[model samples]
Target: MTPIGFVHSTRTDATDDAWDAEATTIHLDGDTFSPEALQGLDAFSHAVIVYWFDRVPPEKITTGARHPRGNESWPKVGIFAQRGKNRPNRIGVTTVRIVDVQNLSVTVEGLDAIDRTPVLDIKPYMLEFAPRGTVSQPQWSKELMSDYWRTIQSQ
Candidate 1:
């Protein structure tokens, strides 16, 4: 598939806690595109971003038992059971509120991507598709998500 453009953000460097990173504007870079590429984009207040965890290490992909908050004694669950950075494909998705859009740059809030992370695709969030069922997340997974949100709100 052809890439219409690329995403540009202030995150030009890597960090340990990629999920806790600050929100950055996702600007469409490179060659121009038809206005249709952005049609109806402003109707939504949020977006689903698909980006590649380009900086994740290959070896860390098998973190079987990890204390998401750095606490071990807990059960050593599978990597998929946790929100750890390492994974088979190292891809991450986040929903962020749209702040503004100017030409190629679209300002948003609540993205967890690290600086310069490679964005694969972006789609406007559909409220009808949002999760509404009960969540049965593992204890560690729940805690990890809570910690990250808390950290983001504090910043």
Candidate 2:
């Protein structure tokens, strides 16, 4: 499918994880997109950005994994189960705050995508539609989920 738009962030690689911690500005590529595209977007405090991990090294996927969450103590989980950069589609979804919007640039809080990431879609945040009641997560996901989410943001 054709990409409808793209995301622009300061950090260009996964190694530069500081962008989330420092609140770097993120811009959208659709400079001429209609304002209607952002309808009701400001009502929520946050949004979910779906994007492609374009720069991930292909060898990472071919070479297999290096342990889940970089923890060798944990069993070897497939790349798909964890947030491995070598995902089949190399797509990433991040929830970030809508700091401001001007023209087509959306200034957001904590999107973990690298610079020039291909944005697949943008969805508004709604607690009712969130994962609060979802139980489909794996046992390891449930156990290793962060207790301090809002404090430290990442993919």
TM-score of every model versus the real structure: 0.77, 0.73
- In model 1, the worst 10-residue window by lDDT is 1-10
* Candidate 2 Cα misplacement greater than 4 A, ranges: 16-19, 22-26, 29-32, 62-66, 132-155
Cα lDDT of model 1 by residue, 38-62, tens digit: 6677888999888877777887676
Q: What is the RMSD, in Å, between candidate 2 and the native fold over all Cα?
A: 4.1
Per-structure clash totals for the candidates: 2, 0
List candidate 1 segments past 4 Å from native. Answer: 1-7, 10-23, 32-35, 63-65, 150-155
| Cα TM-score of candidate 2 | 0.73
Residues 25-128, model 2: lDDT tens digits: 44544554666777677777888888878787776553355566676667777775677667877878878888886655677877777667777788887778
lDDT, candidates in the order shown: 0.67, 0.67
Error of 2 at 148 (Å): 10
RMSD from true fold, candidate 1: 3.2
Q: What is the lDDT of candidate 2?
A: 0.67
